[model samples]
Target: MTTNQLVEQIKQKKSFLCIGLDVDLNKIPQYLLKEADPIFAFNKAIIDATHHLCVAYKPNTAFYEAYGIKGWQALEKTINYINEKYPEIFTIADAKRGDIGNTSTMYAKAFFEDLAFDSVTVAPYMGKDSVEPFLAFSDKHTIMLALTSNAGAFDFQTKEIDGKEVYKHVLETSKSWKNAQNLMYVVGATKAEYLADIRNIIPDSFLLVPGVGAQGGNLQDVCKYGMNDNVGLLINSSRGIIYASNQDDFAQMAARKAEALQKEMALILG
Candidate 1:
Protein backbone atom coordinates (compact mmCIF):
# COMPACT_ATOMS: atom_id res chain seq x y z
CA MET A 1 0.00 0.00 0.00
CA THR A 2 1.06 3.59 -0.52
CA THR A 3 1.99 5.94 2.29
CA ASN A 4 -1.13 8.00 1.71
CA GLN A 5 -3.17 4.82 1.82
CA LEU A 6 -1.57 3.82 5.09
CA VAL A 7 -2.20 7.21 6.65
CA GLU A 8 -5.77 7.14 5.39
CA GLN A 9 -6.36 3.79 7.03
CA ILE A 10 -4.92 5.10 10.29
CA LYS A 11 -7.37 7.98 10.19
CA GLN A 12 -10.35 5.93 9.03
CA LYS A 13 -9.89 3.39 11.81
CA LYS A 14 -8.48 5.81 14.41
CA SER A 15 -5.56 3.41 14.72
CA PHE A 16 -2.04 2.69 13.58
CA LEU A 17 -1.90 -0.68 15.28
CA CYS A 18 0.00 -3.52 13.56
CA ILE A 19 -1.02 -6.83 15.06
CA GLY A 20 1.89 -9.29 14.96
CA LEU A 21 1.27 -12.96 14.22
CA ASP A 22 4.16 -14.65 15.97
CA VAL A 23 2.36 -17.89 16.35
CA ASP A 24 3.91 -20.95 17.93
CA LEU A 25 2.35 -24.41 17.88
CA ASN A 26 3.37 -25.11 21.46
CA LYS A 27 1.73 -21.92 22.67
CA ILE A 28 -1.50 -22.03 20.65
CA PRO A 29 -4.62 -23.60 22.10
CA GLN A 30 -4.61 -27.40 21.94
CA TYR A 31 -8.11 -27.33 20.48
CA LEU A 32 -6.87 -25.91 17.16
CA LEU A 33 -4.87 -29.07 16.48
CA LYS A 34 -8.01 -30.77 15.20
CA GLU A 35 -8.07 -28.39 12.22
CA ALA A 36 -6.47 -29.42 8.93
CA ASP A 37 -4.06 -26.50 9.26
CA PRO A 38 -3.88 -25.32 12.84
CA ILE A 39 -1.54 -22.40 12.19
CA PHE A 40 -3.71 -20.95 9.44
CA ALA A 41 -6.78 -21.67 11.55
CA PHE A 42 -5.36 -19.70 14.42
CA ASN A 43 -4.31 -16.86 12.12
CA LYS A 44 -7.72 -16.75 10.41
CA ALA A 45 -9.44 -16.43 13.76
CA ILE A 46 -7.06 -13.70 14.90
CA ILE A 47 -7.50 -11.79 11.64
CA ASP A 48 -11.26 -12.08 11.75
CA ALA A 49 -11.36 -10.86 15.32
CA THR A 50 -8.93 -7.96 15.07
CA HIS A 51 -9.12 -6.78 11.46
CA HIS A 52 -11.19 -3.73 12.17
CA LEU A 53 -9.11 -2.75 15.19
CA CYS A 54 -5.78 -2.79 13.34
CA VAL A 55 -4.27 -1.08 10.30
CA ALA A 56 -1.67 -3.73 9.60
CA TYR A 57 -0.80 -7.42 10.09
CA LYS A 58 2.76 -8.65 10.45
CA PRO A 59 3.60 -12.35 10.43
CA ASN A 60 7.11 -12.92 11.62
CA THR A 61 8.70 -15.33 9.13
CA ALA A 62 10.53 -17.34 11.79
CA PHE A 63 7.30 -18.83 13.04
CA TYR A 64 6.53 -20.26 9.63
CA GLU A 65 10.11 -21.23 8.81
CA ALA A 66 10.26 -23.40 11.90
CA TYR A 67 7.62 -25.76 10.55
CA GLY A 68 9.39 -26.19 7.19
CA ILE A 69 7.31 -26.74 4.03
CA LYS A 70 4.00 -26.97 5.84
CA GLY A 71 4.87 -23.78 7.68
CA TRP A 72 5.64 -22.02 4.41
CA GLN A 73 2.40 -23.22 2.82
CA ALA A 74 0.51 -21.99 5.83
CA LEU A 75 2.19 -18.59 5.50
CA GLU A 76 1.26 -18.35 1.81
CA LYS A 77 -2.31 -19.21 2.59
CA THR A 78 -2.40 -16.63 5.34
CA ILE A 79 -1.06 -13.88 3.09
CA ASN A 80 -3.41 -14.81 0.27
CA TYR A 81 -6.31 -14.77 2.67
CA ILE A 82 -5.42 -11.32 3.93
CA ASN A 83 -4.89 -9.93 0.44
CA GLU A 84 -8.12 -11.32 -0.90
CA LYS A 85 -10.20 -10.47 2.15
CA TYR A 86 -8.76 -7.19 3.49
CA PRO A 87 -6.53 -5.52 0.96
CA GLU A 88 -6.62 -2.24 2.83
CA ILE A 89 -4.72 -3.60 5.79
CA PHE A 90 -1.00 -3.44 5.13
CA THR A 91 0.83 -6.79 5.26
CA ILE A 92 4.42 -6.98 6.45
CA ALA A 93 6.69 -9.97 6.13
CA ASP A 94 8.80 -9.48 9.22
CA ALA A 95 11.71 -11.39 7.81
CA LYS A 96 14.60 -9.04 8.72
CA ARG A 97 16.38 -10.32 5.63
CA GLY A 98 19.49 -8.75 4.10
CA ASP A 99 22.11 -10.12 1.78
CA ILE A 100 24.29 -9.12 -1.17
CA GLY A 101 22.46 -7.42 -4.05
CA ASN A 102 21.59 -10.53 -6.04
CA THR A 103 20.34 -12.53 -3.09
CA SER A 104 18.56 -9.53 -1.71
CA THR A 105 16.70 -9.16 -5.01
CA MET A 106 15.55 -12.76 -4.76
CA TYR A 107 14.46 -12.15 -1.18
CA ALA A 108 12.58 -9.09 -2.31
CA LYS A 109 10.92 -11.03 -5.09
CA ALA A 110 9.93 -13.79 -2.71
CA PHE A 111 8.11 -11.43 -0.36
CA PHE A 112 7.04 -8.66 -2.70
CA GLU A 113 6.39 -10.45 -5.99
CA ASP A 114 5.51 -13.99 -4.97
CA LEU A 115 3.90 -13.68 -1.56
CA ALA A 116 2.70 -10.12 -2.31
CA PHE A 117 3.44 -8.58 1.05
CA ASP A 118 3.05 -4.82 1.21
CA SER A 119 6.37 -4.52 3.05
CA VAL A 120 9.33 -6.52 4.36
CA THR A 121 11.55 -5.90 7.35
CA VAL A 122 15.23 -5.79 6.39
CA ALA A 123 18.44 -5.71 8.40
CA PRO A 124 20.88 -2.91 7.53
CA TYR A 125 24.04 -4.48 8.93
CA MET A 126 25.28 -5.18 5.41
CA GLY A 127 24.87 -1.52 4.50
CA LYS A 128 22.96 0.13 1.63
CA ASP A 129 23.77 -2.38 -1.10
CA SER A 130 22.08 -5.20 0.78
CA VAL A 131 18.97 -3.17 1.59
CA GLU A 132 18.62 -1.14 -1.62
CA PRO A 133 17.62 -4.19 -3.60
CA PHE A 134 14.51 -4.55 -1.51
CA LEU A 135 13.84 -0.86 -1.90
CA ALA A 136 14.04 -1.25 -5.66
CA PHE A 137 10.49 -2.51 -5.75
CA SER A 138 8.49 0.65 -6.35
CA ASP A 139 5.20 -0.60 -4.99
CA LYS A 140 6.55 -2.12 -1.79
CA HIS A 141 8.31 -0.87 1.36
CA THR A 142 11.56 -1.77 3.09
CA ILE A 143 11.37 -1.56 6.85
CA MET A 144 15.00 -1.31 7.93
CA LEU A 145 16.01 -2.16 11.48
CA ALA A 146 16.68 0.95 13.49
CA LEU A 147 16.75 1.01 17.29
CA THR A 148 15.27 -2.33 18.29
CA SER A 149 13.42 -3.36 21.47
CA ASN A 150 15.74 -6.15 22.57
CA ALA A 151 18.26 -6.23 25.44
CA GLY A 152 21.05 -6.88 22.96
CA ALA A 153 20.26 -3.67 21.04
CA PHE A 154 22.37 -1.85 23.60
CA ASP A 155 25.29 -4.04 22.58
CA PHE A 156 25.65 -2.18 19.26
CA GLN A 157 22.76 0.05 18.15
CA THR A 158 23.41 2.65 20.82
CA LYS A 159 27.19 2.36 20.73
CA GLU A 160 28.70 5.70 19.77
CA ILE A 161 30.49 5.78 16.46
CA ASP A 162 32.27 9.03 15.55
CA GLY A 163 30.25 10.68 18.33
CA LYS A 164 26.94 9.45 16.80
CA GLU A 165 25.01 6.32 17.66
CA VAL A 166 25.19 3.48 15.13
CA TYR A 167 21.45 3.54 14.62
CA LYS A 168 21.51 7.26 14.04
CA HIS A 169 24.02 6.69 11.26
CA VAL A 170 21.84 3.96 9.77
CA LEU A 171 18.85 6.30 9.60
CA GLU A 172 20.91 9.12 8.09
CA THR A 173 22.57 6.94 5.49
CA SER A 174 19.42 5.10 4.51
CA LYS A 175 17.62 8.33 3.64
CA SER A 176 20.06 9.07 0.82
CA TRP A 177 19.34 5.86 -1.09
CA LYS A 178 17.74 5.99 -4.54
CA ASN A 179 14.41 4.63 -3.43
CA ALA A 180 14.57 6.13 0.03
CA GLN A 181 11.00 7.37 -0.14
CA ASN A 182 9.71 3.81 0.10
CA LEU A 183 11.67 3.08 3.27
CA MET A 184 10.06 2.62 6.65
CA TYR A 185 11.93 1.72 9.85
CA VAL A 186 11.81 -0.62 12.81
CA VAL A 187 12.33 1.41 15.98
CA GLY A 188 11.47 -0.54 19.09
CA ALA A 189 8.82 1.00 21.34
CA THR A 190 10.97 0.45 24.44
CA LYS A 191 13.45 3.00 23.10
CA ALA A 192 10.83 5.70 22.91
CA GLU A 193 13.33 8.32 23.96
CA TYR A 194 15.18 7.84 20.69
CA LEU A 195 12.10 8.67 18.64
CA ALA A 196 12.84 12.39 18.79
CA ASP A 197 16.28 11.82 17.38
CA ILE A 198 14.84 9.41 14.83
CA ARG A 199 12.35 12.03 13.70
CA ASN A 200 15.07 14.59 13.42
CA ILE A 201 16.61 12.39 10.75
CA ILE A 202 13.51 11.22 8.89
CA PRO A 203 10.40 12.92 10.16
CA ASP A 204 8.20 11.76 7.31
CA SER A 205 9.12 8.09 7.15
CA PHE A 206 6.80 5.55 8.77
CA LEU A 207 8.06 3.65 11.81
CA LEU A 208 7.07 0.05 12.56
CA VAL A 209 7.44 -0.19 16.31
CA PRO A 210 7.33 -3.69 17.82
CA GLY A 211 7.29 -3.65 21.59
CA VAL A 212 4.26 -2.63 23.53
CA GLY A 213 1.92 -5.03 25.31
CA ALA A 214 3.91 -8.17 26.11
CA GLN A 215 7.28 -6.39 26.01
CA GLY A 216 6.14 -3.70 28.42
CA GLY A 217 6.94 -0.74 26.18
CA ASN A 218 4.66 2.18 26.96
CA LEU A 219 2.30 3.11 24.09
CA GLN A 220 1.92 6.67 25.32
CA ASP A 221 5.67 7.13 25.40
CA VAL A 222 5.98 6.02 21.78
CA CYS A 223 3.27 8.36 20.54
CA LYS A 224 4.59 11.27 22.60
CA TYR A 225 8.05 10.99 21.07
CA GLY A 226 7.44 9.41 17.67
CA MET A 227 4.23 10.82 16.24
CA ASN A 228 4.54 13.24 13.34
CA ASP A 229 2.04 15.39 11.42
CA ASN A 230 0.69 12.16 9.88
CA VAL A 231 0.96 10.22 13.14
CA GLY A 232 3.68 8.11 11.56
CA LEU A 233 3.79 5.05 13.76
CA LEU A 234 2.65 1.42 13.50
CA ILE A 235 2.88 0.08 17.03
CA ASN A 236 2.73 -3.70 17.12
CA SER A 237 1.44 -5.97 19.88
CA SER A 238 1.99 -9.65 19.15
CA ARG A 239 1.81 -12.07 22.04
CA GLY A 240 -0.45 -9.91 24.15
CA ILE A 241 -3.16 -9.81 21.51
CA ILE A 242 -2.88 -12.97 19.40
CA TYR A 243 -2.25 -15.27 22.34
CA ALA A 244 -4.52 -13.56 24.83
CA SER A 245 -6.43 -16.77 25.57
CA ASN A 246 -6.18 -20.40 24.51
CA GLN A 247 -9.85 -21.17 24.99
CA ASP A 248 -12.50 -21.31 22.27
CA ASP A 249 -13.09 -17.63 22.88
CA PHE A 250 -9.50 -16.85 21.94
CA ALA A 251 -10.53 -14.75 18.92
CA GLN A 252 -12.92 -12.62 20.92
CA MET A 253 -10.32 -12.19 23.64
CA ALA A 254 -7.84 -11.03 21.04
CA ALA A 255 -10.38 -8.57 19.70
CA ARG A 256 -10.84 -7.13 23.18
CA LYS A 257 -7.12 -6.63 23.56
CA ALA A 258 -6.83 -4.97 20.15
CA GLU A 259 -9.88 -2.80 20.83
CA ALA A 260 -8.32 -1.45 23.99
CA LEU A 261 -5.21 -0.42 22.07
CA GLN A 262 -7.25 1.08 19.24
CA LYS A 263 -9.33 3.07 21.70
CA GLU A 264 -6.20 4.54 23.24
CA MET A 265 -4.93 5.35 19.78
CA ALA A 266 -8.18 7.06 18.92
CA LEU A 267 -7.78 9.31 21.93
CA ILE A 268 -4.22 10.03 20.97
CA LEU A 269 -5.18 10.96 17.42
CA GLY A 270 -7.96 13.22 18.63
Candidate 2:
Protein backbone atom coordinates (compact mmCIF):
# COMPACT_ATOMS: atom_id res chain seq x y z
CA MET A 1 0.00 0.00 0.00
CA THR A 2 1.06 3.61 -0.66
CA THR A 3 1.85 6.05 2.13
CA ASN A 4 -1.24 8.02 1.29
CA GLN A 5 -3.32 4.86 1.45
CA LEU A 6 -1.85 4.00 4.84
CA VAL A 7 -2.47 7.52 6.12
CA GLU A 8 -6.04 7.32 4.94
CA GLN A 9 -6.59 4.02 6.73
CA ILE A 10 -5.26 5.55 9.93
CA LYS A 11 -7.65 8.44 9.51
CA GLN A 12 -10.63 6.31 8.56
CA LYS A 13 -10.18 3.96 11.46
CA LYS A 14 -8.81 6.53 13.89
CA SER A 15 -6.10 3.99 14.67
CA PHE A 16 -2.52 3.03 13.92
CA LEU A 17 -2.53 -0.26 15.86
CA CYS A 18 -0.70 -3.11 14.09
CA ILE A 19 -1.67 -6.46 15.51
CA GLY A 20 1.42 -8.66 15.60
CA LEU A 21 0.47 -12.17 14.52
CA ASP A 22 3.48 -13.80 16.17
CA VAL A 23 1.60 -17.02 16.14
CA ASP A 24 3.45 -19.69 18.09
CA LEU A 25 1.83 -23.08 17.46
CA ASN A 26 2.47 -24.41 20.94
CA LYS A 27 0.90 -21.34 22.51
CA ILE A 28 -2.42 -21.51 20.67
CA PRO A 29 -5.52 -23.14 22.13
CA GLN A 30 -5.43 -26.93 22.30
CA TYR A 31 -8.59 -27.21 20.19
CA LEU A 32 -6.99 -25.47 17.20
CA LEU A 33 -4.35 -28.21 16.98
CA LYS A 34 -7.06 -30.50 15.65
CA GLU A 35 -7.42 -28.31 12.54
CA ALA A 36 -5.53 -29.14 9.34
CA ASP A 37 -3.44 -25.97 9.87
CA PRO A 38 -3.61 -24.69 13.43
CA ILE A 39 -1.43 -21.67 12.92
CA PHE A 40 -3.53 -20.42 10.04
CA ALA A 41 -6.69 -21.31 11.91
CA PHE A 42 -5.62 -19.22 14.90
CA ASN A 43 -4.60 -16.32 12.66
CA LYS A 44 -7.88 -16.40 10.74
CA ALA A 45 -9.93 -16.24 13.88
CA ILE A 46 -7.88 -13.37 15.31
CA ILE A 47 -8.10 -11.45 12.06
CA ASP A 48 -11.82 -11.95 11.73
CA ALA A 49 -12.42 -10.93 15.32
CA THR A 50 -10.20 -7.88 15.44
CA HIS A 51 -9.84 -6.60 11.86
CA HIS A 52 -12.08 -3.61 12.50
CA LEU A 53 -10.05 -2.48 15.50
CA CYS A 54 -6.67 -2.07 13.83
CA VAL A 55 -5.22 -0.76 10.57
CA ALA A 56 -2.39 -3.26 10.13
CA TYR A 57 -1.32 -6.86 10.78
CA LYS A 58 2.34 -7.81 11.09
CA PRO A 59 3.39 -11.45 10.91
CA ASN A 60 6.82 -12.05 12.38
CA THR A 61 8.21 -14.60 9.90
CA ALA A 62 10.46 -16.32 12.42
CA PHE A 63 7.48 -17.93 14.08
CA TYR A 64 6.57 -19.74 10.86
CA GLU A 65 10.13 -20.37 9.70
CA ALA A 66 10.87 -22.17 12.96
CA TYR A 67 8.23 -24.73 12.09
CA GLY A 68 9.76 -25.47 8.68
CA ILE A 69 7.86 -26.11 5.39
CA LYS A 70 4.41 -26.66 6.82
CA GLY A 71 4.80 -23.46 8.82
CA TRP A 72 5.79 -21.58 5.66
CA GLN A 73 2.76 -22.87 3.80
CA ALA A 74 0.56 -21.77 6.71
CA LEU A 75 2.21 -18.35 6.64
CA GLU A 76 1.43 -18.01 2.92
CA LYS A 77 -2.15 -19.03 3.44
CA THR A 78 -2.59 -16.60 6.33
CA ILE A 79 -1.28 -13.64 4.34
CA ASN A 80 -3.34 -14.58 1.29
CA TYR A 81 -6.41 -14.69 3.45
CA ILE A 82 -5.69 -11.21 4.80
CA ASN A 83 -5.03 -9.83 1.31
CA GLU A 84 -8.17 -11.34 -0.09
CA LYS A 85 -10.46 -10.30 2.74
CA TYR A 86 -8.86 -7.17 4.19
CA PRO A 87 -6.78 -5.57 1.50
CA GLU A 88 -7.00 -2.22 3.21
CA ILE A 89 -5.22 -3.59 6.25
CA PHE A 90 -1.54 -3.03 5.59
CA THR A 91 0.54 -6.22 5.92
CA ILE A 92 4.11 -6.44 7.16
CA ALA A 93 6.44 -9.41 6.94
CA ASP A 94 8.66 -9.04 9.98
CA ALA A 95 11.43 -11.12 8.48
CA LYS A 96 14.28 -8.81 9.53
CA ARG A 97 16.05 -9.71 6.28
CA GLY A 98 19.24 -8.01 5.08
CA ASP A 99 22.18 -9.63 3.36
CA ILE A 100 24.67 -9.14 0.52
CA GLY A 101 23.30 -7.17 -2.48
CA ASN A 102 22.40 -10.18 -4.63
CA THR A 103 20.91 -12.14 -1.73
CA SER A 104 19.01 -9.09 -0.58
CA THR A 105 17.44 -8.75 -4.00
CA MET A 106 16.25 -12.35 -3.89
CA TYR A 107 14.88 -11.84 -0.38
CA ALA A 108 13.09 -8.68 -1.54
CA LYS A 109 11.60 -10.53 -4.48
CA ALA A 110 10.47 -13.37 -2.23
CA PHE A 111 8.58 -11.09 0.14
CA PHE A 112 7.49 -8.32 -2.22
CA GLU A 113 6.66 -10.33 -5.34
CA ASP A 114 6.07 -13.90 -4.25
CA LEU A 115 4.43 -13.49 -0.85
CA ALA A 116 3.05 -10.03 -1.75
CA PHE A 117 3.58 -8.40 1.62
CA ASP A 118 3.03 -4.65 1.73
CA SER A 119 6.26 -4.22 3.67
CA VAL A 120 9.13 -6.20 5.18
CA THR A 121 11.43 -5.38 8.07
CA VAL A 122 15.15 -5.26 7.16
CA ALA A 123 18.43 -4.89 8.99
CA PRO A 124 20.82 -2.12 7.93
CA TYR A 125 23.98 -3.52 9.51
CA MET A 126 25.15 -4.57 6.02
CA GLY A 127 25.13 -0.92 4.93
CA LYS A 128 23.39 0.79 1.99
CA ASP A 129 24.00 -1.92 -0.61
CA SER A 130 22.51 -4.68 1.52
CA VAL A 131 19.43 -2.63 2.33
CA GLU A 132 19.07 -0.84 -1.02
CA PRO A 133 17.71 -3.89 -2.82
CA PHE A 134 14.75 -4.03 -0.52
CA LEU A 135 14.12 -0.31 -0.99
CA ALA A 136 14.32 -0.69 -4.79
CA PHE A 137 10.91 -2.29 -4.92
CA SER A 138 8.79 0.77 -5.66
CA ASP A 139 5.44 -0.66 -4.73
CA LYS A 140 6.50 -2.18 -1.40
CA HIS A 141 8.35 -0.84 1.69
CA THR A 142 11.67 -1.54 3.38
CA ILE A 143 11.48 -1.09 7.16
CA MET A 144 15.03 -0.81 8.42
CA LEU A 145 15.88 -1.73 11.99
CA ALA A 146 16.87 1.24 14.16
CA LEU A 147 16.96 1.72 17.93
CA THR A 148 15.39 -1.66 18.62
CA SER A 149 13.81 -2.68 21.95
CA ASN A 150 16.11 -5.62 22.56
CA ALA A 151 18.58 -5.24 25.41
CA GLY A 152 21.49 -6.02 23.13
CA ALA A 153 20.80 -3.02 20.86
CA PHE A 154 23.33 -1.08 22.93
CA ASP A 155 26.10 -3.38 21.75
CA PHE A 156 26.16 -1.74 18.29
CA GLN A 157 23.22 0.50 17.43
CA THR A 158 24.21 3.10 20.01
CA LYS A 159 27.92 2.86 19.40
CA GLU A 160 29.50 6.20 18.50
CA ILE A 161 30.44 6.84 14.89
CA ASP A 162 31.83 10.19 13.78
CA GLY A 163 30.49 11.80 17.00
CA LYS A 164 26.96 10.43 16.45
CA GLU A 165 25.18 7.28 17.55
CA VAL A 166 25.29 4.52 14.94
CA TYR A 167 21.51 4.44 14.70
CA LYS A 168 21.45 8.18 13.94
CA HIS A 169 24.06 7.68 11.25
CA VAL A 170 22.00 4.86 9.77
CA LEU A 171 18.95 7.11 9.55
CA GLU A 172 20.94 9.99 8.03
CA THR A 173 22.85 7.88 5.54
CA SER A 174 19.80 5.86 4.48
CA LYS A 175 17.87 8.99 3.48
CA SER A 176 20.40 9.68 0.72
CA TRP A 177 20.11 6.24 -0.91
CA LYS A 178 18.21 5.42 -4.10
CA ASN A 179 14.49 4.78 -3.55
CA ALA A 180 14.97 6.02 0.00
CA GLN A 181 11.47 7.44 0.02
CA ASN A 182 10.12 3.93 0.29
CA LEU A 183 11.94 3.35 3.56
CA MET A 184 10.16 3.03 6.88
CA TYR A 185 11.90 2.17 10.17
CA VAL A 186 11.75 -0.09 13.19
CA VAL A 187 12.01 2.18 16.24
CA GLY A 188 11.17 0.13 19.31
CA ALA A 189 8.59 1.59 21.66
CA THR A 190 11.10 1.04 24.47
CA LYS A 191 13.30 3.62 22.73
CA ALA A 192 10.49 6.13 22.64
CA GLU A 193 12.60 8.78 24.31
CA TYR A 194 14.85 8.97 21.25
CA LEU A 195 11.99 9.31 18.79
CA ALA A 196 11.95 13.11 18.83
CA ASP A 197 15.53 13.14 17.54
CA ILE A 198 14.76 10.35 15.07
CA ARG A 199 11.72 12.29 13.83
CA ASN A 200 13.82 15.40 13.25
CA ILE A 201 15.98 13.32 10.91
CA ILE A 202 13.08 11.78 8.94
CA PRO A 203 9.86 13.62 9.69
CA ASP A 204 7.56 11.65 7.39
CA SER A 205 8.81 8.08 7.57
CA PHE A 206 6.49 5.60 9.26
CA LEU A 207 7.89 3.69 12.26
CA LEU A 208 6.95 0.09 12.98
CA VAL A 209 7.18 0.10 16.76
CA PRO A 210 7.20 -3.18 18.67
CA GLY A 211 7.67 -3.42 22.46
CA VAL A 212 4.37 -2.23 23.71
CA GLY A 213 2.02 -4.27 25.96
CA ALA A 214 3.88 -7.45 26.91
CA GLN A 215 7.17 -5.60 26.68
CA GLY A 216 5.87 -2.78 28.90
CA GLY A 217 6.48 0.06 26.42
CA ASN A 218 4.16 2.88 27.30
CA LEU A 219 1.71 3.95 24.59
CA GLN A 220 1.34 7.52 25.81
CA ASP A 221 5.10 7.93 26.07
CA VAL A 222 5.60 6.56 22.55
CA CYS A 223 2.99 8.89 21.09
CA LYS A 224 4.44 11.81 22.95
CA TYR A 225 7.86 11.35 21.39
CA GLY A 226 7.18 9.51 18.09
CA MET A 227 4.02 10.93 16.57
CA ASN A 228 4.35 13.24 13.56
CA ASP A 229 1.88 15.37 11.60
CA ASN A 230 0.66 12.19 9.93
CA VAL A 231 0.87 10.15 13.15
CA GLY A 232 3.49 7.85 11.59
CA LEU A 233 3.50 4.99 14.10
CA LEU A 234 2.43 1.36 13.93
CA ILE A 235 2.53 0.25 17.56
CA ASN A 236 2.47 -3.53 17.77
CA SER A 237 1.26 -5.87 20.51
CA SER A 238 2.07 -9.55 20.09
CA ARG A 239 1.93 -11.72 23.19
CA GLY A 240 -0.50 -9.52 25.06
CA ILE A 241 -3.07 -9.78 22.31
CA ILE A 242 -2.38 -13.10 20.62
CA TYR A 243 -1.95 -15.01 23.84
CA ALA A 244 -4.70 -13.33 25.76
CA SER A 245 -6.08 -16.78 26.36
CA ASN A 246 -5.13 -20.35 25.51
CA GLN A 247 -8.75 -21.34 25.78
CA ASP A 248 -11.44 -21.89 23.13
CA ASP A 249 -12.58 -18.25 23.34
CA PHE A 250 -9.12 -16.95 22.48
CA ALA A 251 -10.28 -14.95 19.48
CA GLN A 252 -12.95 -13.11 21.42
CA MET A 253 -10.48 -12.28 24.15
CA ALA A 254 -7.99 -11.10 21.56
CA ALA A 255 -10.61 -8.81 20.08
CA ARG A 256 -11.27 -7.34 23.50
CA LYS A 257 -7.59 -6.70 23.99
CA ALA A 258 -7.35 -5.10 20.53
CA GLU A 259 -10.45 -3.04 21.18
CA ALA A 260 -8.91 -1.64 24.34
CA LEU A 261 -5.79 -0.61 22.46
CA GLN A 262 -7.72 0.84 19.54
CA LYS A 263 -9.90 2.86 21.90
CA GLU A 264 -6.80 4.14 23.64
CA MET A 265 -5.31 5.03 20.23
CA ALA A 266 -8.49 6.79 19.12
CA LEU A 267 -8.26 9.07 22.09
CA ILE A 268 -4.56 9.69 21.48
CA LEU A 269 -5.09 10.42 17.79
CA GLY A 270 -7.93 12.80 18.53
Say which candidate scores most in TM-score: 1
> Per-residue lDDT of 1-270 in model 1, one digit per residue for the tens?
899999999999999999999889998999999999999999999999899999999999999999999899999999999999999999999999999999999999999989999999999999989999998899999999999999999999999999999999999999899899999999999889989989999999999999998888999999999999999999999999988999889999999999999999999999
Q: Which candidate is the best by lDDT?
A: 1
Task: Please list the residue runs of candidate 2 whose C-alpha ends up more than 4 Å from where it truly belongs after superposition.
Answer: none
Error of 1 at 208 (Å): 0.4
Candidate 1 segments whose C-alpha is farther than 4 A from its true place: none
Q: Please give the lDDT score at residue 93 for candidate 1.
A: 99
TM values, all candidates: 0.99, 0.99
lDDT of 1 at 204: 95
Q: Could you give me the TM-score of model 1 versus the true structure?
A: 0.99
Count of backbone collisions within predicted model 1? 0
What digit string (tens of lDDT, one per residue) describes model 2 on residues 34-125?
A: 99999999999999999999999999999999999989999999999999999999999999999999999999999988998999999888
RMSD of each: 0.6, 0.7
